[model samples]
Target: MHLLHDRGRPLPAPVPVPRDAAGARRLAAVYAPPPDRVHVRAMMNTTVDGAVSGADGISGSLRNPDDSFAFGVLRALADVILVGARTVREEDYRRPQGRADLLEPSRRPGGGPRPALAILTRTGLLPRTIEPDWPTYLLVPRASREAVVAAGIVPADQVLAADAPADAVARLAEMGHRAIQAEGGPGALGQLVAAGVVDELCFSLTHRTVGGSSSRVLDGPAHEQDWHLASLIVGERATLTRYTRA
Candidate 1:
């Protein structure tokens, strides 16, 4: 990754990252969260023109190797992944597995497990194609718990009821998940931003521009927040930027 802008420290010069153990550790350090307490960061990919998806209505078309590498590193460092129900369905979300080499060493000595999945859904609706073995927390409205359970989307033990976005995030922090990352579906991200719970945003900007009616990275009612550029890493086909909430 090329160092374009960095306010923290002088980063190493850009180099082609090999798909190996050492490369994974190096990438994780590029955006590692502070270990003191829970930090909520949003990770999203967008085109140069600010479209979140292409004509196919999916964000995969805009991805490149560097972005995929960064994605895995972020997931490996996170304690739990927060996502919206729509993103889970559209992205075919499943239990993260087979990356023990990347995720295991990041865990605390007695930590419960490596990165659990927590989905936010007000209607308690989930995709039918979700894997049964993939454990997840269905954060639903307190009143909708019964309806969600009846839908058989997930096991009863994994259901978590919350009144608002802040509540769910707070609960996760209480459960010792301090390094949190939200892989969003815009609406959920907007809620977190509106609630003033987001601490940072990691955006991968692809070089291509797909002009259409596709949503921006964060979508919701008009709510403005200030962010400061923390770092910018230029990749071969995309640029990875980290913005901390001001």
Candidate 2:
């Protein structure tokens, strides 16, 4: 990875990213959350033409090496990973493994709890193969919690019913989760944005263009908001950009 632009200003030259433990610590520092309050940042990928997925209906085909590295870094920095039910089913979501190793010891004091996986669902439907041992939470509406419990999709203890996205975020914050990273499926991203809860967005723009009717990084009603470019790193295969809410 190399720095291409910072705050919309072009860099005179690209800086090569180190590939070692020190490098990981440096990259993690770039995205570290503030100590005061919870911050919700979303990580997403899209083709040059704005399509988030390929014809096969999955975003994995659009990912490159740089994107993968950035994704891992984001996960390592987060206290919890948030995703939608649709993404869980389509992506064949599995419990994240060995993520603790990715975290720098200083970032997590005395080997803190590993990042947990939190799924947003209105219907409470999840794949049967979801690991029982994984630390998971289902954020749903209060009205749906009983139905979800009756359906037995997940244990009652793991289910968290919130009135809306803002409420869910607040609840997570109250539980000491200050670094929340939402790996979204469009609808969920849209909801988070609508709730005015997103503080930053890390988008990996693939070099190729996939012109199709696939969903964009955000779906649903139009939301007009301003964000300032924080940094833009150009990789051999793609460009990773970070935008902070302005």
Candidate 3:
């Protein structure tokens, strides 16, 4: 089934042009994807100096109002949002309010066909604090079935028996989710990339120097496949680079 929203008007003018490397990065973030297509974007915000966060020496926390708006637009455009348990636990994730806050209202009528939330975990470690009624799923390894059942995460037929991330995507597809976005914790992204399932990547580069040799975009050794640059958006404090699997 088709998963993208229909557009009747011409696409909005692109977000602004960047004056420097940093600004270019921001512009890249906003214009990275075409308005059409059942695409999946991976979002990450880094420091001007290339850090994901400053807390505990991590550098991902470089947020500006413009960047937030751009992200809001991206989320509004998505059909499903998937993240790792570690991302939610460390990132203070709130249940999506609805599509109105995003870019599409009809899609979010009663608060959404709000992108269904999917959490990746092998042992059912997803927190119990999340709303039970929320359209959420905890994808666990088959060996963890009993543990997940015990934890009360409904063991839906969409279980990914293998721990491979690509298999998980296939299972989600079989269950009828055609388009999927992955919000990652590196390891998960690596597995997805290794499995060869990622369609597009939206990388946000912050303008501040967060000097740390810690983690990076893709966790493991680089894959041999080529990824083409699809688009670019530059924000005031961050640059977003879009890449699609070639």
Candidate 4:
């Protein structure tokens, strides 16, 4: 991994990223949220031609080592991981942390709780990948909470009532979260984009292109918004770009 540009200025040369702990800390600083307020960061991976996944219809097929590095760093900096239920099903999201050993040291003081995973769903139906041991939070409507829990699927304590993506974000913020990471399956990304609460987009592009039937990064009603490039880094296997809402 190497940083090519920052704050709209091109660096004279690329800086090689080391495979040590120092490198992880440096990368974490770049993705860290602004301190005084709640921030929503949307992270996504796409092919050069704008497909979010490969022929098999999962984003995993599009991931490479360099891309995974950036993704892990972003996850490490977040207070919560937000995604739609469909994304959980498709991605087989099983754990709160990935590559924990490669993350920056002392990210949380004295072995703090792992970043919470929040899934946005109307039906409250979860994939089997979500285990009983792994704590989870579900954002759904208030009226359905009782039945959803009565099904013995998830605990009542784990469910948070949210009618929409914006509401889910607000609830998360109220829970003292200042950094929210939105990892999407297109529909969820679109909802957050439409909600107008996204502060930064950590969009990544792999070196290869997948001309499959995969959808673009955002999927929903057409809407337009302006953004300014904040940082651009070119890695050995992917190009990572961060855009701030204008």
Candidate 5:
């Protein structure tokens, strides 16, 4: 991988992204959140034509080795990962296996080796594949709170009462979570964008295009926000760009 830009400035020479253990540490450092405050970073992979998925109809098909590496790096660096319920189901989301050495021991109130998974859903029903155990939290409205609790999917404390996407984010912050990473489905991403909670967008573009009905990275109504490219890199037959809200 080669970096094309850093801090939004054009780099005269490309920088290589290493593949060894030291390389992994470097990659995590590239994604570390600001130490002073919580940062909400949203990441997604898409086709060249803006479709969020490849011809195979999944985001995985649009990724290459380098993109996969960056994905893991982000998960390893985050304090908690916020993802849509639909995305969790579609992506067959599993408990994050964070690199023990890369995890921040100071970000979250409770120090855990891996980033916890926070699932956003208004419905009380959860995917059968999902196990509501420790390190897993559900974001749902108060209306669905009883049903979710009654279903015995997770502990009552793990079921957060929230009516909107912004509410969910606020609740996460209250729990002492910083460096939040939202691996999204467009709908969920859209809501967060609309809520004005998204601080940065880590977008990866594939080398190919798929002419389909796949949604864009953000699927909400008209809501414009200024963004500036924080960094850009090329590798794995894809372009990885980080855009920060301005």
Candidate 6:
């Protein structure tokens, strides 16, 4: 299928939510995108220099209560959270949670809404610990039908093919998901960036540095041009940077 860029219609300009403590208290509203729009947002915490992980191979180091709350604000506004299976399993995500207005009973606390938890994996390997009762979607390679069936989760209509990353984003838009928030493993976020599918990047720059030979943003296929950056906010100990495809 030919990729649908522009989707033949103009989408409304994104509304900006003011940064405040009260805004953090509010249950972020869900984004309802038009059927044809493919809106993607990536959320990641990086060191002062931009390493997603440390030399110890631990990513949990990149979390703070303030940063976590900021992430909740973004999650409350999202229709769904799209993450790579490696991140999911490695993170050992059990259940998702949400606060007052954002609460969807189906998901765990601080986990945001029942908006589907979408995972991208080529091997289709999923942890048996997670119950099939929750809302989840798996995007896997076309060749992994058997594994998908074994997992007993419904595979999306568009399975990632040889061009898995490209197909994944296209399928996401087709499935009526307007805003996709990519929670990372670096490679997955890079894939979305390379495909030009990402719309906004809500980056949390922490105060520390993990100097190592690890991945930085956009480590996937090389882009001929640089991405556009906007809305630079400098916090007390952290900075929030937003980016869009130029």
Best by TM-score: 5
- Global Cα RMSD, each model: 2.3, 2.3, 7.2, 2.2, 1.9, 8.0
**Candidate no. 6 TM-score:** 0.75
- For TM-score, candidate 4 versus 5, the one ahead is 5
Query: Global lDDT of each model?
Result: 0.79, 0.79, 0.59, 0.79, 0.81, 0.61
Give the worst 10-residue stretch by lDDT in candidate 2: 103-112
TM-score of model 3 (CA atoms): 0.75
Candidate 6 positional error at 152, Å: 2.3
Error of 5 at 74 (Å): 0.6
lDDT of 4 by residue, 108-205 (tens): 32123567788888887888778756657788898887777776666777788888777888888777667788999799899889889898988889
The predicted structure with the larger TM-score, 2 or 6, is: 2
lDDT of 4 at 180: 85
Which candidate has the highest lDDT of all? 5
Residue 232 lDDT in model 1? Answer: 80
Q: Which regions of candidate 5 deviate over 4 angstroms?
A: 99-101, 104-111
Error of 6 at 184 (Å): 1.5
Please say which candidate is ahead in lDDT: 5 or 6.
Answer: 5
Clashes of each: 0, 0, 27, 0, 0, 9
**C-alpha positional error of residue 182 in candidate 5 after TM-score superposition, expressed in Å:** 0.8
78-143: candidate 6 lDDT, tens digit per residue: 556788888887777544433344444322222334555678887877687555555566777768
What lDDT score is found at residue 78 in candidate 6?
55
lDDT, candidate 3, 108-220, per-residue tens: 21234566677787676655577657667677787886667676655454334546776677666555565577767776776677677788777767666656674675675
Task: List, residue by residue over 14-59, the lDDT tens digit for candidate 1.
Answer: 4544556776776666677887777899999998899988888988
Off by over 4 Å in 6: 1-21, 25-36, 97-100, 103-113, 153-163
* Least accurate 10 contiguous residues by lDDT in model 3: 1-10
Q: State the TM-score for model 2.
A: 0.91
